[model samples]
Target: MAGSENSKCRGLRWALIGSVTLNLLVAGVIVGGFVAHDRHPPRPVVGDVSLGAFTEALSPEDRDALRRAAQKRVGDFRDMRQAARTDMTALIAALQADPWNRAEVEQILARHKARTIDRVDIGEALIFERLEEMTPEERRAFAERLLKGAQRFDKRLDRDDNRPPRP
Candidate 1:
């Protein structure tokens, strides 16, 4: 009976030792994690959910310069749009001339295609980058289709706009 008692005492001692060791290990990990976090708190990135960092990154002078540059770019784009409108007007006149000029029609189509590609490529790159689930080939095909569709739409509009106004 005493031998059995001794074995029971031994088992209880081992159990207590194991429980204390496990508790210490858990406590140590928690304390270590806290210390590490304090030592290396994450630095905020500019424009990453923190407007303060983004504002801080820009100097007042730089911001002013950026604003001016942005205005200039807008103006340049407006000029391009106006130029396109003028070309379209000339195209309409050429097509309406007593003898339809095939060369003028082709030239107008080419200019429209170039402008359409410029705008479409920007959208294509954005869509390709943002679509997380598409495979590379699928993304490429989608971008191609997008560009073609934009060009076709621009061509159709150009043709319709050039037609004579109803009396």
Candidate 2:
């Protein structure tokens, strides 16, 4: 009947309108989530270091000195890393070469091991030098800040059993 056809058309139109409205609502929600996420990014966690907290406790002058020290240390570290990479690459090639000599590989590995140890020692020495630059009071305060941060980090871990520990 003509009446039945009219009813069917009306129903289809309403269903289409409802679907369009829902899709627009969902799109709005998705856009909102993205905006919100961008505005409030997660904070970086660096183990128990609390580098930010330690820096906040320092005076402006101390902070400037610390920045300079960090820049120098980073530059040195990059140079060392590059050298290490080159050495490691050479070692890998030697190890992979056809008809490799065990004695030669062993010698190369021993030398590489010594070089790596030296690099670690130098890095630690740099860190120690920075520590020495700070006053005893500053060092004590930094220790306290590190402790509090660790406590806060542990409490966050307790909130969810299924979640793995954060670095």
Candidate 3:
């Protein structure tokens, strides 16, 4: 019957739309996360990937300068990361406590997330300040390196996800 056909067509159309929307959302998250994460050096995680990114584009002296700048603030970053770890530990412990409360967990998570964001903000500020002092050529080269690094990261993620290598 025409009505049956119409129903099937409607169902197919909705399925197609839903699939496309989901794909778009996933792509947006991937792109957004990549850009935000790529803006900084990797976290000091045990399995962190090394981008070796901007150093190839920099003069020895400039690279040294950047290294020194980062070195100077390493302790500060370590402290911030430690604070985040501490907060996470406390959250986990509370989650294990009697009478678990969803509201309390949400509040703790939000505060922990805010602190993490603040740490990133501080890191970005430092990088931006360093870039501001760089020569125009250096800034351009660094941008190129960052783009390449991000692309490499994307490919690695795709491989991990068992997706086809991007064209």
lDDT values, one for every candidate: 0.56, 0.61, 0.64
Cα lDDT of model 3 by residue, 57-79, tens digit: 45566556555666666776677
The C-alpha stretches of model 3 lying farther than 4 A from their native spots are 1-64, 150-167
Error of 1 at 32 (Å): 69
Candidate number with greatest lDDT? 3
Candidate 3's displacement at residue 160, Å, is 9.1
Q: How displaced is residue 76 in candidate 3, in Å?
A: 3.7
Cα-based lDDT at residue 117, candidate 2:
77
Best by TM-score: 3
Tell me the tens digit of each residue's lDDT in model 2 across 1-167.
99999999799668645644553565567568667987877532211221444545555665555556555556555675566556555655665679755576567557656766775665455446767888888788767776887787788878677687799
Model 1 C-alpha lDDT versus the unseen true structure: 0.56
Better of 1 and 3 by TM-score: 3
Clash count per candidate: 0, 0, 0
Candidate 2: RMSD over Cα atoms?
22.2
lDDT of 3 at 37: 97
- Worst 10-residue stretch by lDDT in candidate 1? 44-53
